[model samples]
Target: MSLSPSTFETIVPSRYITFTFPNHHHHHHHHLRVAVLDSPSAATAAASTAAIWVPPGRESDWIFSTFSGHLQLLLTQPLSRLILIGNSPSSPQPISYNSSLHPSSPTPLQRNLAPLLSALTPKSAFLDDGEIPEVPLLVFEDEVVKSSIVEICEGPCVGEMLIENVELENDGVKEFRRRLRFKRMPNFVQSQMRICPKNVTSFENLDNMKFELDRGVLVQPYLNPMVAGISVISRFLEGRTFRPKALCLGVGGGALLGFLRVQLNFEVVGVEEDEVVLEVAKRYFGLEDDELIHLFAEDGIEYVQNLAKNLSEECRFDAIMVDLDSSDVSVGACAPPTEFVRKSVLLAVRAILHEEGVVVTNTIPSSKLLYERLICEFREVFEELYEIDAGNGENFVLIATKSKVRNALEANEGAFLNKLKSVVSGSYIDSIRKIPRTADPAF
Candidate 1:
């Protein structure tokens, strides 16, 4: 038999409840359940309330069933009421009635499910156990107009009723179909994933590719080319002049190190995982004929471990710059585990940095938690910390020094900005001067 869309609705006394729906699409009445919570609370209470939604099925049921069970388990007490709406025989009304009567009363379920619910639905206001619950009316519609439940307020049948039902030709299905059509186009493919180095080369030879200083590469405070580019150069200069050796981890395209070599004339040993990127840089990024630029095709972490084991005090680098992937964006839009930031990569950074040397890294500015953890870790090892903005929604650089340095920018701010202005050929230096000296707490 062909499965047809059907809508079912009901009402229960408890503030929390779940309704299951049969999945006829797969020749089975898959139990789909939705749980409604009046408030938010801890896990224990939410779990007790969610237990009611589990039907006589194993853990590997339909998608909806599994989600409902997980949601049930996550809801704790002190949460508000829960309303489970689904196509099952036991599904409840999509909307709850008389929820505003206990304005000050707290529903444990609502509190616990607030974050997930907020992501799925519109914002809501609820009263604390001692506060007021902000309840609003909502409409419901589904495929196949079979049944509905309306919550009635005061005055018998004359009060406001919450309506939940399905339509024979569901509007949702039409929208989905429309979206799928757009997804079939070629341009849409580019939006899904970033262009890789090979594709970039295929589109245009690396030598032919022109680097422009567009808004994508420039932003406020970092507009001063000298400040943005030279600070890096000056840091290296300080290390090279004083200690005379440096190492870089995850050097992509060698643009950063190349800039340092050309502008500041500093020799840098760079390790890159992708030989293609290194080759492209050498060919196109003015890296050719620069003996100061040394390229290594090795994993950055492994390189650090080897350096630690093989390098003596005299052979150790005076400074190290790391620009590894902190998230999918840096790693070509691939989501990495949190451990990548917390342990593996961080340990590698520490292993390579000299005893009294400096280590600089590029990381997203919005990741306050990660930034805090990094700062905490550095505090245990380094004597000073500094950060600089690179602008244009790009990453910020964190500089940790083992020795006392007045400031990373030092006296090179003006000269560096002037140099960058010469290279990018823009008046961005004026805007860069306005950036507050204080580092953003979020970074």
Candidate 2:
């Protein structure tokens, strides 16, 4: 029963749901979207689990830094319904009885939250043993999710449920207010906030990493994968007769933002949705709100979508480097990576890409299913694709380019290598050299 690829259709229906903390005046787009094809899909699960904080508290820091402690799934992976169990008006309304994700329904997903209390309750001494647990806030079709201020921790991410002790507060409302607390090491905090070079011990490198306000820019080695992705892009551009225009997504620490502007001299634009993040970048990362590097506080997906729909051809880039981190180096791939690397986003990338241009993304290949899906989706959009392994294969840099150099198309291997050498030199030179100039498909 072999079926033709063109004739085949997806049997598994997919669901795309978005969640976020309530919006503020300056940051209105505070939403995170997750797409789930089915349970057990690594990429889908990763994206859904990307951002759940235990609320920031001084007491929560000890548990987060512990070697190993309690762990639990924040939300159901392949999330069908988002339940906020609370009396608050801002909470999402419960899902109707007929909806597929309803826990009371006779569906496989109904079993997801059967033991909700036990699953969310982490074994920690901070909790009161006699305190009865009640559903304070549940925002979903099935039930209400209790609302709690999650503290961002800094340490290991065991993926285990280790909640700090819960203190049930009597808000004098009809139902008891459940102030839940959970914690995990903030995954990309250091990568985004700190500027460290490869050789941190050397005094000269340390000095180079320092940033003073309104002066020279700062960068971090945490962006090694992006560095590699950009190098591959530069090599491709150098083989051609045209210059490179670069775009960077996620201005968390402005590592790539600084590198592209100062080192490579590419006309660069950095897009970040978080004003708080952008403010931090300006204050700490030596990033200035200036004309040379255009900074936009908007969602990357919607930004690119609008750029393609509204903007003219002249606004496109020769090189686009996206660092909306798709994986936790310690845990594996997550949903944001899935969102960023999906067919739609990749196609949007292709829409704005120069016929001779390239786009690169940061990912972790440690997760087999996520890694394979990434390569597969990338190939669906670009003419040629390449990857560079970083941190001894911990991080994977995906380079997808619609354009190919004349030498490469003509099978002139030696000339192609020479051109790559010329485009990249210094610290970046060694990393790009580690990856073969050709794809594994070339075999």
Candidate 3:
């Protein structure tokens, strides 16, 4: 029976027992603590699943619910962890409950259980009715309670087995023949596998193949060796003094390093925030020590800030390239807040750039909002801005230059294309060039 609104208890157990609500402002501070509380009889039964609800405005509720849900669903037999269900007023979404019975009409509680739902097994079924089943279920609504379930899965499987089940009929064989015919086209290299049937009859023309595999041919795109920090230091004073230096803010593994080194030949300095990535670059990527190359382990913005303060007036970098975060686009409702990007990071970048220097940013193609915001911020600091569209799926590079790039298309076009070719390689550069460039200022 539904409880009357007047008599219903407004207080519910908190999803996070250690931290309080809304005031826990720092996103990084709220830790999700989950505890599995099973029924006395099922104490030995693995607690596999858990559900949590978060209210609006309470930071702890959101943190616990989302993170705990991820942890619970990742465990094997997560259904056993079905321990506690708690609520908070700060939650914007309804709470999700796990039940094998009544799969369609599960009751919507005033809590956020999205984290658990995300971690739930793809095969796991849910009960539709509002009522908690005879199966173990925990329900609470508050900001200070840690909810969890018992662990069931022992360890993750080391490797996955590949199972291919192909059933080819007469029509499928005919289609395969057609594919083989297409592969015989002049443009199609015979070394590229032609579709063939499993039967011996399909090998009739195998001896006619003339092409050998070209080991020298690079099929994949060129990758930067220095993933993060990329800087170009120009020389003056008859090769004795340093002139304008350019730094690439957040390079990934020095994919851009090859281009800057070969084309500009400027003293390149790369800074990376992740220590593990830096080590990986050194070990796997061909990053070497030289007079032009310097590496540092530091955050991009912090490094720039320090450089701005310490570097001599003539020693400041003339250009800076930035590519931070894995994907250019931000997804989901719980994406990192906008303030962090607009204020903290972007502002710091502008603060460090030289007045006459340029800041080139590589961003995801689909993230229009982020691109616009970046342009707006750059416009505030620099007078000239140009963007190069590397096509869809490929990343776009924005060149925010202080020096009015004289006849950008004519002057820098050759250098830009050559740099792109050297860094990205032959076939990759061709593919990138196939994508048209748009000069829309809004982009």
Question: In lDDT terms, how accurate is model 1?
Answer: 0.40
| Residue 282 alpha-carbon offset, candidate 3, angstroms | 0.5
Q: Alpha-carbon error at 400 in model 3, in Å? A: 0.5
Q: Report the lDDT tens digits of candidate 3 across residue range 6-35.
A: 321111212222222232323554433333
Query: Which stretch of 10 consecutive residues in model 3 shows the poorest summed lDDT?
Result: 177-186
TM-score of each: 0.42, 0.50, 0.41
Alpha carbon lDDT of residue 60, candidate 2? 26
lDDT of 2 at 67: 18
Q: Output the lDDT of residue 182, model 3.
A: 10
Off by over 4 Å in 3: 1-244, 262-264, 326-356, 365-367, 412-443
Each prediction's RMSD to truth:
17.7, 17.7, 18.4
TM-score of 2: 0.50
Note the clash tally of each candidate.
48, 47, 57
Q: How many angstroms is residue 53 displaced in model 1 relative to the true structure, after the best TM-score fit?
A: 37
Q: Which residue window of length 10 is worst by lDDT in model 2?
A: 93-102
The global C-alpha lDDT for each of the candidates, from Candidate 1 onward, is: 0.40, 0.44, 0.37
Return the top candidate by lDDT. Answer: 2
What does candidate 1's lDDT look like per residue over 48-158, in tens digits?
Answer: 222132222111222123332223332322333444433343332222112112232322433344333332221223224534323222222123222122121221211
